[model samples]
Target chain A: MDVILLQLLNGLDKGSAYALIALGLTLIFGTLGVVNFAHGALFMLGAFCAVTVQRLLSISFETIDPDKVDFLGNPAKVKTPYVESWFGPEMGGAIVDWSVPIAILFAIPIMIAIGFIMERGLIKHFYKRPHADQILVTFGLAIVIQEVIKQFYGANPIPTPAPDAFKGSFDFGVLLGFDPNAVIYPYWRLVYFGFAAIVIAAVFAFLQFTTFGMVVRAGMADRETVGLLGINIDKRFTIMFGIAAAVAGLAGVMYAPINSPNYHMGMDFLVLSFVVVVVGGMGSLPGAVLAGFMLGILESFSSMNVIKSIVPGIDQIIIYLVAIIILLVRPRGLMGRKGVMED
Target chain B: MLGLEKKDTSLLIIVAILTMFAPFILNPFPEGSALAQFNAGYPDLMQRFVIFGIFAIGFNILFGLTGYLSFGHAAFLGIGSYSAVWMFKLLGYNIIPGIVLSVITSGLFALLIGYISLRRSGIYFSILTLAFAQMSFALAYSVLTPLTNGETGLQVYNSDPQYFHSENMPNIPHLFGAKMQGTYSLEMGPWSFDFNTGYYLCAIIMLGMFYLAIRIFRSPFGLMLKAIKTNQTRMNYTGLNPRPYTLAAFVISGMYAGLAGGLMASMDPLAGAERMQWTASGEVVLMTILGGAGTLIGPVLGAGFIKYFENIFSKINDTVLHQWFAFLPDGMENFVITIIHPFVGKGWHLTLGLLFMAVVIFLPGGLVEGGQRITAALRRRAGRSGRSGDDASSTDTTPAE
Candidate 1:
């Protein structure tokens, strides 16, 4: 029971990331009918946005402290952040500590602007192009974006610590009446899981309740009919694109604290998210989310030492193995709508 | 002469002539000159140009003809390399058996993968292939270490069982007795040319493969594959099974990739898991698309261009850039160098990405189409009165659409 619960929690973190990215991929595919290979770059950009904010917040000036002697036997130089000088040391220090969370607000507009520009500028020209062209162009864009980030940040992963409050692990096994140290998990992972749940719910709710989302949903179902209804479905779809980008951005922003932000991290996730999207069935939002979690749980379970000992490398290929089986047995995928990319 | 049509025969002759004298053509600059860095006539790079040409040519047979954009063709290349290296380790250093086994094994692998992956069409097919390739890569990188030798990569070691080992033979991969890396540098007054046995051998194979690709493009099976690409439903209604045709194309391309990979190992005996990664797969796709997918000569041209750019452009550093622009004023030169520095040397990938995007966006039919457009426009300007001439026969030799 402890092992299962532990794996489940572990699964949720990976599932959240997969679901979030796949959700955005499905959104773009469903609405604008573009297969966005560069969506991952947007996620990377969002993480970098957090990095940028942290850097911006902590921009500091050096001054010599006469009280502290340096290693060279001179007065020590003390660096004070500009935020500390501006907002007073305590408040500014607190803000710096919580920059990763605060970056959510900063990334939203930037991501939305990026999405709008991407849709309006490059992707708009590729709307009538072949799927191959769309894929190639976006892949090229992704490479360019990652390369730019690599140039600025270097190739090393940048550590972005979570808030001090969420630094420690929670003993779930003890909470559930098992041994104390049986199934301890980091607090931030739980926070990430909760955050993903809320984001997924908000997106679902917006689509369910709002007229704009209804039109967007209709557009996904039958684009011609929605367009013939004298509705400007394109504008709504563009806004949906922005929303999708924002969702992916927010996911990356939070994930920065979990895994250190690296230029290639988005690419590493993108491939798996693509697998999740395919296994969930293309353009199926709920299917994507469902498969994301299912695959995540499956992946987590397979990675167990017992399973590894049995299969001797099953963990490395379990997701793909499962994907192949599912795709062969049920071509449309679990929870997939009829005739959505069936051809 | 080789069972080719008149136009194809001429193309074959032209390509043959070009490959035969590549050392001369590629090495335009004099020895020890500043522009010598731009020369790509070296054996290693020349081998790559033709080897990748073969790979791209094979990829084009499927993607260009059948319109099935495979995102995992590099797995076959990796498989081929592994098999070839194993042959070298198990058998003697002779390349014929290694190359033959590589093609056969990769063909079988392709047959199995294609059988399953072809169950779906379009993006699903691409995803399925991608999944299989990624699985292979992951397995090779971690679990399959015994067979693959894992992170250190499979290489010819001193302790490997060499039942056919002889004191007189070279340790590196060889053909019968001739060393693959043997090069004879001819120093002509100003220009120097390196004639490598390995490059010539690869060149011959590439020409043979190119000839085979030409024949396949003109064959009835090729037309059938193109027909499927045009409308699979229509072909099915006409009582044609597109499955066998696509599978055959897939297998053939896989073998081509295998042959390329074998040749790669023949030149330098090492096979890494990175060869099977999706990025490598993307490269062949880029090569095919950049050259003009369906055209007989396009893939080769694309392969050469990309390989050349990777080799030559990457060699240009800020120091070199500064030297080139030293004729300008100090401030202006420094400004220009700084701006230009990022897109060259280690930043060549950035330039490549930008160039790839521009090509996909602006020239969808690739460099061939771009060349055709220019020639057509020039002809129109010269004649001024001809109704865009039925020269479509010349330009549309192999239709990409």
Candidate 2:
């Protein structure tokens, strides 16, 4: 029972990421009627945005401190961050420690601008083209974006630490009847889960409550009718694209501390995320979220030692395996609508 | 000749001649010259040109004729490579058996995947293939380590028990006693040409395959595949089963990929999980598109172009850039080098992606279309100066596509 609970938590955290990415994918597919292969690259860029803020916060200068002797018997050159100099040490230290969260504020406008440029410049031209063309162009764009990131950041993964407060594990075992450490989980992962839930909720609320989102929703169902109604539906769809980009970006920003930021990290998640979107049912936001969590939990369970002991390397391929079975059994996916790529 | 139309037969003959004399034609730049670096006349690169040509030609059969965009065809290629390597390990150092086994294994794998994946159409089919390929790649990289050798790649070992081999036989991959890597370079004046055994063998197979592709393209099955591409719903209404036709195309393409993969191992004698990755599959798609998907000779041209750029353009560095731009003013040369630096060397992929985007956007029919347009324009200009301006105008309005 404890093992089950622990795996569920693990699944939720991973599922949170999958849900976030799939939500963005579904939004774009729903609105634009095009598949954006560069969505993962946007996630990668968001993580890099966090790295950028961390670097910016920790910009330091070398100062010779006469009080400290060097190994070579000279005055030691001590490096102090500019943040520490501007603010007092404690405040600046805290600011540097919490750069990942602060990156949310930094990543928003940049991601929005990126989203705007991508939509207006490239994707706009491809709106009426075949889906294969859209896929090919976006795939090319993804490669270009990843290569640019690689050129700047190098090929290696850069470690971005979480805040000091969220560093340790949370003992869920003690809260339950189980012994301590039995259901141990990372606190940041919990934070991530809560954060994902909030984002998903906020997106839903905005779509349900806001006038703009309602118009967008109407456009999604019937673009020609919305256009006939004299709403500038194209602009709204463009904004929705930005929102989707922002969602994917935020997912990447929060995910930085879980996995180190790397140029190819987005591509690693890309195929799996597409599976999530497909399994969730194309263009279905709630379906994407539900399927994300389901797949994630199943993946976590498949990776358990006992399960792996039986199948040897089931963990490496469980997600894909599940996807194949699901696709074969339920051709339209869990929540797919009629005539959504059916032909 | 060869059951092809007169025009296609002539095109086949031209291609055969080109491949036969590629060593001489590709080595036009004299050795030790500044432009020599651009030349791709060596056995390794030439082998790649033909092998990848075969792969792309096969891909075009399915994607071009039937409009089935498979993003996981490299799985078949990877399977073929592993099978060929295993054949070399278990049997003697004969490439014939390895090549045959590779085709059969990949054909079987393709049949299974196509049967399931073809149940769905359009994007769903693409995603299904992608998932299956990724699953295969992950398995090959991890659980199938005994078969695939994990990250180190599958290669021949010193202790391999070759049951059919004698004590004095050459251990490297060979055709009877002839080594696949055997090369004879002939120097004529400033121009040197290489005649490699593996390259000629690969070239002959490619010619055969290209001829086969031409025959397939002109056959009744090919027209049916095209009809399916035009409208599967209509085809269904007309009582034609699109499933079997598509499956056959898929399996045939997979076998071609397997043949290419087998040839790859025969030449190099190693197989890695990376060959099965979706990126490799994407490369074949790019080749097919860049050359012209449905047209004969397009895949070959596309494959050759990409392989040439990948091999030759990537070898260039900032130093070479500087040398190339030395005639410019100092600051201008530096600026030019800086601008060109990122799109070459390790940045070749950036250039490739940009070029691919440009092709998809502007030249949807790929290089074949582009070539046709240019020639048509040129012909129109010539006719305008002469007497047949009206005829030229009529031909210009209707694109060959």
Candidate 3:
């Protein structure tokens, strides 16, 4: 029971990221009628934005120690990082620590702009094209974005540490009157899970409570009729696209500390997310969130050693396997409406 | 004049002669010509061009004709490769049996995959095929490592010991005393012609495939497939069951992929799970589209073009750039070289992506359409007599890939 509980906690954290990204994907697909294959790349870009912010915060002028003497040496030694002096050694160090959390603010506007540019510049022209063409072109765009990132950042994975405050694990079992190690979980991952819940709630509240959100939801259901009523359905759809991109970007920003950011990370998540979207029922937001978390937890549980001893490589492909089964059993997916992606 | 409707029997003779003497025509540049970056003369890449051309041409038979986009076509190619390589390991390098086993094996694999996947049409069919392909990829990567040889891929060794015809064999069997890559060349001032025997073998296969494709394109079955493409429901409502016809078309295309895969193995004798990946599957689709899907010759052209670009693009270096910009200012030239540097080597993907995007955006019908547009424009400028003179032949000039 303890092991299961621990796995469930771990699973929810990872599941939160997957759910957030997939929710954004389903939202975009519902409103735009275009499969955004580059959503994964956008997530990756959001993570990179966190990394960039971290670097910027850490940047400082190097000081030359003129008093120290080394024969024929330039200024004896070059003292690096005036950060120690700018905000004092301790505070300067800690002040620059909130890289990922700070990145949320930076990423939103950037991601929104990127989303708009992507729609207005490239994908807008392809709305009338076949799915194959859309897939190919967006796939090309994904490659271009990934390669550009790789060229700048190299192909290696960059580790983004959470703030010092959330570095340690919390023992939940002891608090609940169980043994100490029974339900220990990382504070940051738990924090991430909570953050995801808040964001998910915020999004739902906005959509269910606000006029803009209502208009978007209305547009998603029947854009043709909305357009007939003299509303610019295209404008709403474009804003919805921007919102979806920002959501995925925010997920990536928080996820930077959870998973080390890498260039090809986007491609890795792409196929799986598509499977998630399909499994949840295409264009279904709540279904995407539910299915994403369910599959993530299932995948985590499947990877347990005891489970692996039987299926051998079940962990590597459980999501896809489950996706296939669900798609077969329910052709419309868990909550798919009629005639979505039917053709 | 090569009339559009004429049954040109000489086309066969020409193809045969060309295949027989491909090496002599292909290998003239002595390894340093401007076009030296491109020597279809190399047996491995050349065999790839023709064989994959055959594969894409076969794919065109289904997708181009029936308008059914089966995303899992690479499964057949993978099966074909696996079977051929297994034959080489179990039997001998006698590619005849290898080719035969691969065709049958891939045909069966296709039969199963197609049968299950074809139950759903449109995007559902595509997703089913994708699921099957991913399943195959995963299985090959992990579960079926015994057969697939896992990540390192299937390879041959010297001590594998030929089970048959071992007496006079030197390593693998060769055709008529000619090794696979044995190049023969002749040179002039700025041009050259060279050839290899294995190229002739591949050319023979390519011509056979092209001819077969043309025949299929003209046949009644082909007409039926096209009808299914235009309206399958109409055909079904009219009392014609489309399943067997589509199944047969699927199997035929799968066999073509198998043949291509077999030829690929025979060229270099290795089969890896990478060939079964979705990306590899996408490449064939891209080739078909780039060359003009449904056109017999277009897919072949696209395959050749992409293969050629892939090989040439990777060879470009800073020295090549400096050579191009030798007359510019040192600082300006250095800047230019640095700017252009990312496009070569590891950055070949950038160039490819740009080119792919451009083609997708503007040339939906592919290069064949571009040719048509140019011809139409030329005819418009050529006065009143240009209408029937060239349009008929121009329109029908698909290479029958």
Candidate 1 local Cα displacement, residue B76, angstroms: 0.4
Q: Among these predicted structures, which one has the highest TM-score? A: 1
Pairs of residues clashing in candidate 3: B23-B194, B23-B195, B23-B196, B24-B194, B24-B195, B25-B194, B27-B194, B296-B401, B297-B400, B297-B401
Instruction: Provide backbone clash counts, one per model.
Output: 0, 0, 10
Per residue, candidate 3 scores C-alpha lDDT tens digits across B1-401 of 22213443454456556556655555656557565765665666677778888889889988888877877788888889889888878767777777889899999988987886676666557667777787788888986888888998977766665576465654553543345556665566665665655666777888878777777877889889888887877998999998888889998999999988887777768899989887788788878888887776678778888887788778888887888789899999999999998888788877877777787789877888788779777777775655554545543545332
Error of 1 at A190 (Å): 1.0
Chain B global fold similarity (TM-score) for predicted model 1 against the true chain B: 0.97
Please, what is the whole-model Cα lDDT of each candidate in the order they appear?
Answer: 0.90, 0.91, 0.80
| Angstrom error at residue B259, model 1 | 0.8
- In candidate 3, stretches whose alpha carbon ends up further than 4 angstroms from where it belongs are A65-86, A172-184, B1-35, B38-40, B158-162, B173-194, B239-241, B384-401
Stretches > 4 Å off in candidate 2: B387-401
Clashing pairs in 1: none
Q: lDDT order of candidates, best first?
A: 2, 1, 3
List residue ranges in candidate 1 displaced over 4 A: B385-392, B395-397
Candidate with better lDDT, 1 vs 3: 1
Lowest-scoring 10 consecutive residues by lDDT in candidate 1 chain A? A334-343
Categorize the docking of model 3. medium
Question: What TM-score does the predicted chain A of each candidate obtain versus native chain A?
Answer: 0.98, 0.98, 0.94
Question: Model 2, clash count?
Answer: 0
